[model samples]
Target: MLGSLLLLWAGLLLLYFLWKTRRPKNFPPGPQPFPIFGNLLQLNLKNPMKDFEKLSKRYGKVYSVYFGGKPVVLLHGLQSVKEALMTRGVEFGGRPQGLLVNDINENKGVIIVNYGPSWKEQRRFAMSTLRNFGLGKLSMEERILEETSHLNSYIDKSAGQCLDPQTLFHNALSNVICAIMFGSHYNYEDQSFQSLIRMITENTKIINGPWGMLYDTIPLIRSLPLPFQKIFENRDKVKAFFQAKVTEHKETRVPGKPRDMIDCYLNEIDKRGNDGSSFDDGFMMVFLMDLFVAGTDTSSTTLRVGLLQLMMHPDVQARCQQEIDTVLGERKQVCYEDRHRMPYVQAVIHEVQRYGSVVPLSVFHATTQDTQVLGYSIPKGTMIIPNLSSVLYEEGQWKFPHDFNPSNFLNKEGEFVKPEAFVPFSLGPRMCLGEALARMELFLFFVTLLRRFQFHWPQDGGEPDLTPHFGIIQGPRPYRLGVRLRGRQSG
Candidate 1:
């Protein structure tokens, strides 16, 4: 009887393997996946970006790769990405369920939450509220400029000394969002805010690291204690911090009058009042967390990488400063509107975003329903990985796609011209919620800093490494810059 049972189990295992390895009819082609393990073995979890790029060459763009028996479509190049994210956006606009990020977030936030009533409701509300609170308006620019002043002072103190800008930029950007979220900004010396920034940095690193890959691929091992567990721990701590803020808001908030995002949300909840809407305290906590993380990380990382690029290319830096000086002319501060008059400076900032390619993969998107990309059928709920790096660095897209050159954004007339492929912010209905605020902040901060200080690689610091340490967001490897006050500095 024991021998018979073993034989039956062996046959069942074989059948399971076959089923898992099989692909649906008309599915985009890719490397054959291993049973159970799927294509996990084929990727370098540490950083699968280059691996994905290589596979695109072998399997063509819009190919599929399996993660633990689940097939995910990887969209490459400008054409495929545009078709999926723009032409057929709604059909390909759902977040993947049961992933590490969704699980950690409990799928309540605006980012990873599924596309449906709740997502629609939260997104609409967030967008309107942000605009009302001055996202793209002059009021919002004022808020960002205020934060830029703090950043200038912080850097001013370290002038002519070797200083690492990682934390400085992170803290500055975090405080910018904090004002919008909490109606106030934290002191540069605040321990709690610093801790919060550290957690966000660590979480972004882990979310794209090897452990995050392992957690996503193998369900059987998820319950085991592992480094990925730290993600959950960090999530809990962040949730608690944001939750406390929510509790405090509830105490001080007045109905029909909103101070910031939290106050606006509370007013919204009251207006909806048990209407069975997605508006509630539970979702609000995660929503706040999402806004904070989204608002802070990418822009900050871009600034860090932008500084590195400037240090490496002093000519680019000097030219930008010259443009800034010519345009501002003793103004003592730069504004968002000033970008129009300073085409070269605008080009350099855009190039920084292009060269940085900070959020490379662009938060994983899933198929909301059955869809077709370039005639290949993608089933409902299939995972979509848009290789934005492909388009950003596509061979024919820009004059110098592989190198950092402001000319990428400049026309022969020396005017700033954004190419169709310059999508550092992913294009779609579900594109970055904080896009306008980020653009304004990047312009104000970069212009302000370049006007006030000249950033250069330290004398002892050998060749600056242009290669960014890959994460969910790419950032420069830790390096310090020597700051010298520019002639006629901005106050």
Candidate 2:
């Protein structure tokens, strides 16, 4: 009787394996699957870019790999990614849902939610709110300059020493978004704000790691007492922080007088009440959290990586200072208009983004309708990973794709020329909504720091590692740099 049962179990497993691997005749080519795991065992688990590159070499530009039982198409090179995301955006703009999104956001917010009427409204409203809040005006520039002043003051008192810049970057960047979203900025020493920062930092680390991928791939096991359960718990704590803020705004909000983003959203909600949409308190909380994280992590990581890049290449740093001194002429503050006169600085900024490649994989996009790419059929609901590293480092798209050279964005005339492959903010309808604000922050903060201080390697002669920490953003590991006040040359 026992031997008969064992044979029956083995027979059932074989049938399931065969069913999972069976696909339509015209599906993209990929590695053979052993069983329910598919080619998941072949992946690197930590850095999937290397694995995807290997698969691309074996299969082709458009190929499929299964995570658990689900099929995911990995698009390699610039043309393949553009064909799917830019050309066929409406068909491929939807987001795939699983434990990572549904369990965390309840299938809410602008980035992770499926693209449709609700997503369109929320995204459009959010972008417009940012624009009305002075994303292009001197007011937005002033917000960044205010944070720069605080950052400079913090660094000034800790002068002549090596310092880890992680929290400093977070505090400054988060404050800018807070002032925009909540109508005020927190003090650097605020305990509650510090706790929120900790949650956001922890979230980025966990959400991009292998465990998060596993949870999404095999959500059935999520119900058990497992380590991955901490992600949901941490998510709740972060949500509660924003939820309380929403309540406070509800009680104190006035009619016809919007103070900040929260107020504007509240007014909109009241206007559209009982219309049966996703415009409510819960979605609003998730939206605010989305803005806070998107605004904070990538920009802060870029600024952090920017300092390390400059430290490694002092000549580039010196040239940037030279341009600033020659153009601005002892100006205490640099504005958005100043970028028009500073090409070298702009080139350096673009190069840092290309080299850093923070958010190496564009956010996962799903097909809302059946789509065909490169003469191959991509069924509706297929998950697409547009390998951004392939685009940023594509062979013919860049002059020096592998090096940390600023000439990648410069012409013979020393003017900044943006390459077609420079999609650091991604592209198409699902492109980064914070492009205007992020560009403003990057320029203002980069100029402000370089104008005031000179960053160098530690006095102990230990070299800082440029290898990324590989989270949501490919941030540098927590490292220290020697900071010194520069002369009035760049003032």
Clashing pairs in 1: none
Predicted candidate 1 versus true structure: per-residue lDDT over 8-105, tens digit per residue: 99889878877866788999999888777789898877668899999999989889989977999999999999999999999988999888899888
Q: In candidate 2, where is summed lDDT lowest over 10 consecutive residues?
A: 482-491
Residues 246-323 of candidate 2 have per-residue lDDT tens digits of 889889999669888999999989999899987998889889988999999999989988999999999999999888
The true-versus-predicted C-alpha distance at residue 267 of model 1, in Å, is 0.3
Q: What is the lDDT of candidate 1?
A: 0.88
Q: How high is the CA lDDT of each candidate model?
A: 0.88, 0.86
Highest lDDT: which candidate? 1
In TM-score terms, candidate 1 sits at 0.96
